[model samples]
Target: MPPETARLPLAHALALGALHGPAELVPVSSSAHVELIPRLLGWPSAALPADVRKAFAVALHAGTLAGLLVLVPLPSPGFAVVATAPAAAAGLLLEDPIERRLGGVRATAAGLVAGSALLVAADARGATGRGAAEAGPADALWLGAAQALALWPGLSRLGLTVAAARLRGFDRGAAFALGRQAGLPVVAGATGLKAWRLARRGVDPGLRAPFAAGAGAALAATLAAAPLRRVTSVWPPAAERVALAAVALAGLRRSPR
Candidate 1:
């Protein structure tokens, strides 16, 4: 159930989980962690059964995602939660397809490039006079649509949400807060529903360990959020987005398989 649990060094396990958690929630892609970690650790493919690996990854997301939902300072958590619903629903429906063919190294690299470009563009626009206002339901719906794009492995969920918010006229802080808050319910609802279904089917519930990882990730995300905001403010939002996208894409390309 817990990956090939022959008692991997506890340090390795925790380190892996911790690193992935924070990195996943930022503008970076979580899938990149799943793809990169194994190679970095020289972990064998068989170390975790495929299903276990997937479940663990999802669980980790839940934890960090949940942490953000509960902890982040936002204008309206309720509105944020409401906005994220459609994207979450879309994620639930498309999970299977995303898992099967999200693509390999090449595709991931390409996605990073695309995502970076978008980030740079966002940064270029700058937060100067944007993202200050609260978003409306229509704006939230549009943001949700942007988030759906993040289902792609390399796309940054935060980036998409921010982009959508900006497009709808929210300033930087507001956009970031909106995106961060919106994801809260999606993580909780999906994780709870899946765990429930698994239990109903008589599957071991321990399979949900990644959720813990996600919580750790949420802490990590908080640490990063403020710094990231400051950095983005230094540039035009659109340009910053594009710059980040290129850098991430270059890293993806250079990473060893």
Candidate 2:
């Protein structure tokens, strides 16, 4: 059979292209989408190709960068810089070992289940209060450390950051915002690595594509706000996340290796 095409609807195309950045800033799973969309569409491969995945990451981060710029008009670029330092440091330190050996589907699934449980318990305990608060430099560093856990693929940076924030006594909105702010540069770095890998592989330069994709992702992030607001407003990201993890794990268990 010929390679199947994963056709994108205009909106979804634009959204997927645009939403990478902020969508991830929230407690949603962008990597899960990266892994799931191709499977759902029955495309040539189970996951998107490295090039496409890279493009998607760049696009989403672009949107996120845009959203952050728009949202924070003044006096926080320093905060963004500081917050990302730990994740960047941790990522560089762990890249070889994590990607070479520990990163796998089963591990990702287990991380998902565990992360989901954490979210559920924290939410049920009413740990994430309402509104934002001041996060210390230490908190930012710790949150960055928490984000490194997401390198395993199934672990979500947002989920982990939010969970960490809740544990640190940040109210819900504060934890979410802090997590988003901290994660922005991490995704940007991932996009840059993807670009570097693509360049090393002699792929054509995608200068225009990243911008277009970022815009698309921005739109998606905007649209996603409604559902996310409604869902997260209820707290306990654990319930839905656990259900999703269970389903993904069950499917993995049944799939032919």
Candidate 3:
């Protein structure tokens, strides 16, 4: 998804938000969905500035973070604080440079494939009582590091975290629970940081309508997630994400925006 050529209107903004809410919950990369939704829907090819795209993504994430709070039991507050460290550090210190270098459509598509592979591998492992029940400081550190991969566009934060947990012996539900808990802080931190930066620079009045529309769509999708995700096992992500990445990469032959 090269910078969108056309202004993202309220309807399109809501479309992107609807995609983000559930994709973030599943193994699919929410960022990848955002990157593709515009193009996939036949938006114009004009180069959308990166900052606008970034701002929209940040706002969408905030809406979903709010949704997570309602549907899941968070890890203890102390655990949430310490566990969020590595990804938070990576986002604050490394995300900009990474986005500069690897935020391209091709690069992001590759991330989608890479992340999808991880999900498929985790699925292949099947459910086993071999799952571990212990949560310790070491677990927090390890999971946090794994989640740092999410700073890269098209890398699914939920996908990587759940994959890490599943590999470490957490059952599917447990992995999902832990991943959600670990994710909240990172999402909150990044959203807050981006909001601060936007405020400091002063937001463009043009951006407000789309941002509000996107956030509202996300909130609605998130509220419906409980029933939606119950039937959304790991299989669809394992398969659908690869197809999505392939489609995205195929359409990405245009010169860099």
Best by lDDT: 3
**Between prediction 1 and prediction 3, which has the larger lDDT?**
3
Highest TM-score model number = 3
Looking at model 2, residue 51 earns an lDDT score of 48
For candidate 3, the 10 contiguous residues with the lowest summed lDDT are: 126-135
- RMSD to the true structure for each prediction, in A, is 4.8, 4.5, 3.0
After superposing candidate 2, which stretches have Cα over 4 Å from the reference?
A: 1-22, 45-52, 71-78, 124-133, 196-220, 223-231, 234-236
lDDT of 1 at 221: 54
Question: Which window of 10 residues has the lowest lDDT sum in candidate 2?
Answer: 1-10
- For candidate 1, the per-residue lDDT at 146 reads 73
Q: What's the C-alpha lDDT at position 36 in model 2?
A: 50
lDDT of 1 by residue, 1-257 (tens): 45354333434445655665555345666565555555544565325555555555555565555545545555366566556777788888897887678755556555666776776576556344544454667877777777778877777676677666766666666776676666555555666776665455443444333345444654565455545533324134334334544554555557643
lDDT of 3 by residue, 1-257 (tens): 23242377787788778878877678788887788757655663124677777777778988887887787666777667777888888877887699789977778888888888887688568454443347666767767887887777777888888887777777777777677778878777878888888778765677678888898889888887777556437777867878887777777655334
**TM-score per candidate, in order?**
0.72, 0.73, 0.90
Q: Give me the displacement of residue 237 in model 3, in angstroms.
A: 0.8
